[model samples]
Target: MAQPTTSILCTDLGFDWPDGTTVLDGFHLAVGPGRTGLIGLNGAGKSTLLRLLAGELTPASGTVRVGGELGYLPQDLTLDTTQRVDEALGIRAAREALHAIESGDTDERHYAAVGDDWDVEERARATLDRLGLARLDLDRTTGELSGGEAVLLHLAALLLRRPDVLLLDEPTNNLDRHARSLLYEAVASWHGVMVIVSHDRELLQHVDQIADLRAGSVTWYGGNFADYERTVAAQQETAERLVRVAEADVQRQKRDLIEARTKLERSASYGKKRSESRNDPKIISGKLKRQAQETAGRVRGMHTERLTEAKERLTAAEEAVRDDAEIRIDLPRTAVPAGRTVLNLDHVRLPYGTRAHLELRGPERVALVGRNGSGKSTLLRAVAGEIGPLEGEISTPVPLRHLPQRLDLLDDGLTVVGNVKSYAPAADDNAIRARLARFQFRGGRADQLAGTLSGGERFRATLAALLLADPPPQLLMLDEPTNNLDLASVRQLTQALAAYRGALIVASHDLPFLRGLGITRWLELDGELRTIDPM
Candidate 1:
């Protein structure tokens, strides 16, 4: 094996829970050169392992040895209250440090703080520029940027540290497709060992390895995301077959044990006298009969216990093996008026102080693509009736619901169930609970403060609200619905859309999904909607 430029060796890594629960098992992870995509469902010990590798959390049982420097940017980052994008990236601070260093009044202490080199300020600026944050407002404070923007700025800061190992947990969670592209390119060109946990299948394809964590152990898969899927599918099929075989064996063992005991069942033909003799026990004949009965009972009990234990063992073994992902969703019926133009905006020009005009129509399932702030959301809002155009009018002659890019539809303070209730009040709790279950948000999860839910859960909850509404929106308008979703969720959502009959106006950057869905038409940010000619 060629020595990795950077690597971390984790042996039997484990972590305990607050309630003496073991969240991380004897998980062994070998992180090395190139990109590695770490993935797991919500409570699956993925984040815990990432924290261990980053040194933020220590293992309860194992040693973590890092071969080189490591930089980490968590999915959720807390910035200094008054920090600006530029300051967070160390650009402005670096400049200030330099000014103080050059104006030195023989103060060696200050010089050492900024790295013995006076040119460090220049390097900071160069790094910030490479991160596309060169034009950031240094004094204005990060409170001005959106969640997605804040994530990017902090990522730039970590990159500034230039660690040999780079770890980003769900880095693309809140970013738009364009922003995600920025990450994709950066990770591809990065030379250090990079470990990432993202829900984007396309993003996972960029990695060199896939690690599946389950049942307290780690299974390593070579190759990228696509390769892993095929292998996993085959493995799941075999596992299911094995489960059936094990079950059959357990049943067969139970029958054999029962039959063996039945054979040992003594005949009662010795009559009541023999039976009474066994009961009396003082007579020799009675003693012999009692001994035989006692031996037979013991033998049967032993056989039963062993078979029962075998059955239990088989059950545990079956569960320990990996299974198929749960992807079934039941979206309630919503009627899209047949043979009618759902949305129409002819010679529709956007109002003053915004992006240009365009002629478009509803009942059109098309993607909206453009660079960030090139007016994708602005146009979407116009279609959603949140904004009015100065130059022309947009007529929505059909029932429609829009899932925005920023997910601004939500008010942060409500609980998951409460927010969902706001959309469909008349839905009895059971019906609502069922809908939430389909989206993987039910029970205490639905009771959790929506604000506390992770990016993915929040997005999913929002989707549940939209699709499970009273009448369900026939025409669905979504703004980058894939932003916070992991690759599995994205795939599931895509599968759901595949079966949808209503008109869809979506804005997404997942090219594979776009092509897979055979999206027939699209509108660009410049008020241009083009149809892909059918072959």
Candidate 2:
């Protein structure tokens, strides 16, 4: 019944990159005990703000205060492969000390280490179990786990800390559906202050509030993502209406100004004619002319001022609208005939000894869905000819390209244009630049080094190169392509896919994304491929 307590606060926070690019300026936020989802377009500085709050990055100015201990899981996570689970959980030393005491070694140092945490092992196991890692052993090395399992283990360690404030950045990036469900459960059970930066709509649905970050400022929205969407849509409708009204007012004022000028011109002509005809005294005529001139000037100035104000109103109204561009390119060359066989797998022995047999015709779109460590990537690689299966006959009648989740297909040292050039050796420089522009890499942006690009930019660059390959690929395979993309980028990808007429084989855990792709077939890759209804 009581109001939740404030656990995080930032006042007049400011930060800028070393290149003098400002990200946040005079930012202010106060978060209480509840989950808050932070969302924004790519390059909106969401990660930057989280880093500042976690004390991982120093702010250029202003103060950040936390009411209690904090736990942070960054988007770019890297764990030491050789570290034991208990060590990663910050309890290995205590467990060892406890064991020594139980074995009749009563050293004071061991007793000190085991002071008040005699049940540490039990608590660790319980936390792991709660995270759906019940089968995992504390002594197991981190290298023995899958990528998604590693992410869950990291989250479990943070939960064991029991910090009052928790920060997560794209926590579901590597997690499978089951692991994502487990994470959602953990989030639902948390009573502390939680701030998560994620593009996952399902994850955002569990939050108590949404923090819309844009141009270095945060706007609060009550309720979940769907609620936020409805509210934002209403706002956009109002803004658009205002813009229309302002535009009309500007047109009206312009017409009035034109009429005023015409009247003034007529009055001046009449006055000159009267003076030339000598119809009245010179002084009286002059005085009459002066009054007419003054009236015309006032009317014209008034109309001009009204028009300027109307233009200003229109500008203000337009500012309220958001720009989320769609990819509208037509990939005609990528289209395949109805009877064309794009790919065929004849009793292929996939990784982990799973056998798969399939045939894809025309532009059939297949979505590969399954739990983590189910060999999705391995299968995709085999299809792309990046690797060969132990036993099988595979055939690809059309050019195929694979987009891996890591997006490591790009050369870090090369520019985007250079990468595209390598993929399309026959295309000239001007032609390459022109095509790159369609991918949102206009002019100088195409010159940026791949290593320095943000996640979304790198994805775009990779996509551009793949789509713009020398012969124009007729079949595309993507593995978790939306992993770290922002909402806008995901929409861009969806739009791009919608325009493609080629066959698609995409392996993704994001149901919304896969659905948006208009998948014609759903294939679950458990140990082997099996056709199933779409999720």
Candidate 3:
């Protein structure tokens, strides 16, 4: 492996949205060769930072210095549909020149075009194969490829460049299991500086380190996600202990101050009474009274200062404890009886020509796993009645709702509450807003236009709209629900699903996420759908 020629450095980096929302301020980071996973909450500027480093976006004020070549893959990657695979790989000219030379053209221009990468085609093919795109034809147009395949192709192109610094934003979002495995292998074998922003737990496990972006800053962890979690948990336990100790200290200090004040007040009262009773010498009485008042002030100040210091310590201790809130929700109305049959597919031929025979009972949680283009979304749409099956029939006994990958159920012009209201006309605005609040949209946020929401926020709004529907969907089908969600959002989704009592059939490649949901059945789809062991 080639050593890094230059490290990625950022000094006094600052960035803001067009609307003047500051995302990064005077930020600094120095990254050398090693795979680093960038994890953060939604709207943490992970993607923006990557774009700035890639030159896709300019920092407001700062320096971004890269020692060597850089390649970047954005979250939403789009290629010209008319462009051929060879062109997309960036080797069209070279490949054509090589072909001309092989045909005995003997043109000097051809040689110049080929340069030293005479085996570029072979290398490209090898790279594609490594990314599980071995069957993709170099001459084929990109229009024919699926979303996941396009991502793999783009990665192959970047790998061919042998860049010193590579950045990927949510690379595995829409990828299938096979593609994810290939990506994991690539990351494991990477020798250069790699920064990836993703919520995929499996992908994060392969990184050498984790960079947590929060509150417009980055905190580095020495190992992968699991290690990071362990370290954070340990730190949180210590913080909680400190907070408890600090609270106890504050209480003690408060009591001490009160007791001291009471004693001083009582002593002052006694001194005044004694002075009044004595009336021996005016000068002596005055001196004694002044001394008592001064002493009381001194004592009061000392106790007050100690209490203030204790309270400050308590505040600092509380600040040290992380306040990452968990999603608390209830979906009792979505429940189905244990013996209720929620769905039945009898020899149903999917749009992709594959036949599926399956039955979902009670509140069974099913995971639909397959390759990228194996019709998971298609089948999901069929079940949702968005599209009809080619043959046979699909029987859904309860109210069903489908959360598609694109989240098109929401109208961009409508507010989050308005979208929900559209779905459940009988539901009042207050009721809808209350349910939206459970999905993390509170107060004014519930009235924010769907078009203005971030990717994660949009997904949550869509989910809220679905679950908050009148009659409450008892058969929920989600297609790639975790695609653009941050780790926190993903966990929120998991928590929400945990409370849901409806039957679920989610098509996703996130194995950890599926297992977290306690899936009752594992179904794999290739040309046909079949049950598989939960490995």
Candidate 4:
């Protein structure tokens, strides 16, 4: 198979933060004309690379060359809520120019602004329609649109621009199932040079290839996410085997070195005894002793060199093995009895007009899923007692804790252990540290300030605090827990949740994650709480 044309190229790329922290140094990449899924751990420079390619950040060295026009959608899109839809789409000037021309204003400025693209409005509308925004009016303010709609609108703007190179940073983040499907369709249909930095498995499944970024470099893998996973798993298995073989070699070398040293020592002792017994001439004995010492030194040096080489090989092999830690904890105290009532909502009317009347019993794992702006977060907040319902009662017979989407419950000024201590005041320091270790924050990690943690680390720290809270929450609620998490972190969260025996209610758009949780019930909130099948 012939290689696709390289549309995005970076060579000897170097970048550093103002604090002198190096993000990328001598990094090189060549992305061809197809969808490339860029994946890496949090803070591995995936977003930074995209920004460089999009010309949002100036590189300290090297060049970024694109074959044609480029467009970028950053992870955090801050759109002015007061801006009109047309303004956000970037065609408002052209639209106004055309209107002026129609009104008999033949100013050269108007003609220049209108350019040759007379049907910009038509193209914008068609683009919006393609992205499932057919009903979105150009005259409406951005505030009128939901979060998902806003994302799609930004994408529509990029699509209308028809850039040859497109870069998307976590495009599906915070998107609902329907919006994600639309985004997936858009990605699947893209025929340009597209590089997307996302951890959304479903979105990644639509890519043409995978670019595994680590240590400021890219390793390309043919095919989509599943193919990448299979290849990486096989490679890891081989790496682990190599590490085992290296370890065995090191042990053998150590044993050989010790044996060689012992034999030399025995030989020297035997020589000394023989010399004393034989009563040889003084000069002859002295010469023989010196020769024996030289031989012994050579033997010991050879064995020592071999052992050093073996140990070096072992270290190299071990370096190839990934150390992605996982969360492991047992929370028997959080378990709920089969006949216990966890929560009850009596005709609860949320602030956003969504009404829910439900009773949660036993250790039910419930999935709360719906479109954006459907009041999923609001409902979760109401249940958590963070907000009072419009005119209803929510009762939790047992202790409950909520992990909101923003994860702001943690105090940035405090350490991970300190945060957990705040939640579990009665727990001793050693006990809290031990429990935190299970969450992968052992020793120094637990003492690091919350403000200094990466996204995944912060998530784990917050989760530990919640689960280890005093009184032990029997019912735990999480709002979009998987958002902004790397794939490994997602797996870690799944493992942690697996050990959770409490009643769980999670509001998330991640179907794969929800399915893995063994959700016993699925609920959709859209002005009314309705039982739905697990999508």
> Looking at model 2, which ten-residue stretch has the lowest summed lDDT?
321-330
True-structure lDDT of candidate 2:
0.90
The candidate with the higher lDDT, 3 or 4, is: 4
Each candidate structure's count of clashing pairs: 5, 0, 0, 0
Ranking, lDDT, top scorer first: 4, 3, 2, 1
Quick one: how many clashes does candidate 4 have?
Answer: 0
As for TM-score, the candidate ahead, 1 or 4, is 4
Off by over 4 Å in 3: 1-5, 279-290, 411-438, 442-449
TM-score per candidate: 0.74, 0.92, 0.93, 0.95
**Which digits, one per residue and each the tens of the lDDT, describe model 2 over residues 366-419?**
999889888888989998988898998889989999998878999999999999
Error of 1 at 441 (Å): 5.8
What are the lDDT figures for the candidates, one per model? 0.72, 0.90, 0.90, 0.92
Best by TM-score: 4
**Predicted model with the maximum lDDT:** 4
Tens-digit lDDT track of model 3 for 185-304: 998999989999999999999999999998888899998999999999999999999999999999999999999989988998988898888775889988988998899899889989
What does candidate 1's lDDT look like per residue over 1-535, in tens digits? 9865578788877799776878876667777788888876555777777888888887889788888888888876777757765578765655566677677744665655566556765665665566665666556687766666777788777776778888888887656666877777777778878888877777888998887766666688899989999988887777777778778878887887878676765443354366575565457655666777787787778878878877886787688565424446755476455576777775566643444444334345677665555566777788888888776677777667888867666667988788888998898777777777777775888788777776667777777788777767777888877765666667767766765667787877666666666576766664444444431
Q: Give the TM-score of candidate 1.
A: 0.74
| Shift in Å, residue 24, candidate 1 | 4.5
Stretch of 10 with least lDDT, candidate 1: 526-535
Model 1 local distance difference test score: 0.72
Put down candidate 4 lDDT per residue, 95-168, tens digits, no spaces: 99999999999999999998998999899888998888999888888987877788899999999888999999
